[model samples]
Target: MAVTITEVVLRDGLQDEPVVVAVADRVAIAEALVAAGLREIEAGSFVNPRRVPQMAGAEELFRQLPNPRTVRYSALALNARGVEHAVAAGVKQVNLVTSASQGHSRANAGRGVEEALRDLEPVVAAHPSVTFTAGISTAFVCPFDGEIAPEALLAVARRFAELGITRIGLADTLGTAEPEQVVRSLGVVRHELPDVDFSLHLHNAHGRALDTVDAAVELGVTRFDSAAGGYGGCPFAPGAHGNIATEELVAHLHARGVPTGVDEDALADAVTTVRVALARGRSL
Candidate 1:
């Protein structure tokens, strides 16, 4: 199966960054990503500017993105308000993230898992023009709540399934999941939800994010989330580090003869743009 890498550097990757990058630089980085053959990019998130100051001008950033008709620029929408903001900015794809762990859910979404899922239903119903992906954060473990049971993960996924959502993204928010743990959880979800499509959003804190990618590929998951410069981490989930770098993951998959359709040399230019932006320490 062909692999699809959704680069999340601008949203998930830059949100946890120290220096806030300006919107103009964000547009430059995104342009480079598209030039590198990234058809899908998590361009930004529509959340509280005060809460995640790094993502302050998301609407403005989306307005300035390149190749609007050809490239898929998605945004993370944490709630109904966020959905509204993204739609207003002309974002057609929305990533609805809810934590599988109740503790992280409250920390990230300011509600328990049930409340978070409950709120998503109306939001999904309200936005028929937008395409939504159900992203379950802390799919394997949570910093505050410990290991998430497989049943817990399935329950969260099933709720989204009932919403008629076909795509589900399982996240290892703490970067603590092992190969065996990956097989068990992902296998069961695929078995039970045969009609539902799945993807992985991994981190490299333990240096095993690639290993999990290998395991997921073994189970036929072709879609994986990555970052251009290996930049990522969760403000709510402690211990989470950068995502599996886009170039690193692409190289690993190519070495094994998997096709990703991304160019590494051009990807480096996108990565450099982020590094240069951080180096400048620019904001707003």
Candidate 2:
């Protein structure tokens, strides 16, 4: 099986960090990931600096990125203003995020699920040229609200499809989901939206991320979102930890004879660079 791994070290990986990484460092990290054979990278979120200080220089980071044609660089946008900022910043791709659970949606996006979906309508309509991927956070479980039903996730997936967003990512925001649950939920979504491509965004909080990956691959999911050196967490999702390590995910895929197209050695170097950058930022 072949898979496309989207490196998130520059965005979700650093969103909750105590020390904000410099734009130069973010760009360097992104370049390294591309060198490591990552074709897709989530550069940053177009959000308020006050809320997510680590992502304060997202525009600069995107503006300074080199070799734009080789890799697909994307940013996350929670609202219409964020989408506008991303569009103005020349972002070619954007991830529209909203939680599957209402409580988590309200906390993370400051609105209910339906309200947030309504907010994304115009953003999608306005950006016909830029690729948009809908990310349904807390698809498996929500910290504020317990295990979300599969129907709830499918509903959000349907909405994304209705909005002409064909690519969708299901996020285990709190990392509390088990393999069985992941399989069942993904199966339902896949059955309902057969045409939409699906990706898994997992967290390693409970150390079951790989198990979930195994389940996903069995179901023919070929896209995943991972962070370098396992650095990330959600400020709004209590008990959530870093995403599944990129190197670890790559190693697992390679061992299973799945072609991820990522060079393990180069990926390790990228991970080391990310770790060093974060450590250096902390010292300042």
User: Candidate 1: where is the Cα deviation over 4 Å?
Assistant: none
Over 1-284, each residue of candidate 1 has an lDDT whose tens digit, in order, gives 78999999999889898778888888989988999999999998999988889998998999899999999889998888888889999999999989999899999989899987877789898889898987999999999999888889999999999988999999988788887787799988888899999999998888888988988898899999999889999998888888889999999998999999998899888889888877775544
In the range 190-231, model 2's lDDT, one tens digit per residue, is 999999999999998889899999888988898999999988
Off by over 4 Å in 2: 282-284
Largest lDDT belongs to which candidate? 2
Taken over the whole model, the C-alpha lDDT of each candidate is 0.89, 0.90
Question: What TM-score, to 2 decimals, does candidate 2 have?
Answer: 0.98
